[model samples]
Target: MVDHKQYTYRVIWSEDDGEFVALCAEFPSLSFLAPEQSAALEGLVDLVRDVVADMAANGETVPAPLTGKRYSGKFQVRVPPEQHRSLAIKAAEQGISLNRLVSSMLSV
Candidate 1:
């Protein structure tokens, strides 16, 4: 049995509807809206559980949730030559490695 709680869920406020919107990144097409954030999250959990059960009953593959996935904490990004030079100069001025400077910028 799939544990719905293991899924990655988000609750965001909706200005147009004046309520909270619940979404699971693993199932992008589905959403649950409610006035309260907790209610929206609960609705999403129930919906995901039902979908998992239905898929299992029909012998369909239930997509895995993304919560437990591992990441390497490293990735590459390309920048224009001018921007790269500027960043390098900035890092030198700060007396920090370019990698450390970029990592600190991204955390913000």
Candidate 2:
């Protein structure tokens, strides 16, 4: 059984609902809201547990928690030729590689 707690979760105050809203990154379509932050998170966790159980019982593939995945720290992004050139120039001016420049910008 997948641990429900392994999924990424966030709780934020919802201005429109006037409550704390709980969200799970793995299950974007599911949410729970409550007057208290704890309740909101607990409710969402319970919901995810139930859904995961249902999915498993029906022989469906459950999403792996992001935390359980391995990343190579490398990804490709496509940019227009002009923008690429501009970035390359900036990197040259800063005495850094184009990849370093882009990585710094993205980190900001």
Candidate 3:
């Protein structure tokens, strides 16, 4: 049976080419390039699995998902309308939701 433990990936957009890129960040050499977004992502997943199997045979560490406590918190903050608008625009530019942007900033 094929081992499903192998393969991990993250999808990111390439600003210069206006295309989506799937990066196996843990195994830099494992990547895929395709003109279509879905194909590129699917190819990346396959490549990552192959790379992981090779690494396993070589006795290298297989990539594993992080396991940690999930954060659950909620609060409300008051900001001026103009500032809120600016924050929303900045978050959109970074391709993240406003809550994520604020949470990251607050974490640091």
Compare the candidates by lDDT and give the number of the best one.
2
- Misplaced by over 4 Å in model 3 are 1-8, 67-104
State the weakest 10-residue window (summed lDDT) of model 1.
61-70
What is candidate 2's CA lDDT for residue 24?
Answer: 96
Ranking by lDDT: 2, 1, 3
- Give the TM-score of each candidate: 0.85, 0.97, 0.48
Count clashing residue pairs in model 3: 0
- State the lDDT of candidate 1 residue by residue for 1-108, as single tens digits: 678789999999999999999999988998999999999999999999898899899999888877777889999999999999999999999999999999999999
Q: lDDT tens digits, residues 1-108, model 3?
A: 234334346677777767778776556766667777787788887776776678788888875633322455888999999999999999999999999999998999
* Poorly placed runs, candidate 1 (over 4 Å): 58-60
Estimate the lDDT of model 1: 0.92
RMSD of each: 1.8, 0.7, 9.9
Q: Write the per-residue lDDT of candidate 2 for residues 34-79, one digit (tens) a residue.
A: 9999999999999999999999999999999999999999999999
How far is 10's C-alpha from truth in model 3 (Å)?
Answer: 2.9
Q: For candidate 2, report its TM-score.
A: 0.97
Q: Which pairs clash in the backbone of model 3?
A: none
**Which prediction has the highest TM-score against the true structure?**
2
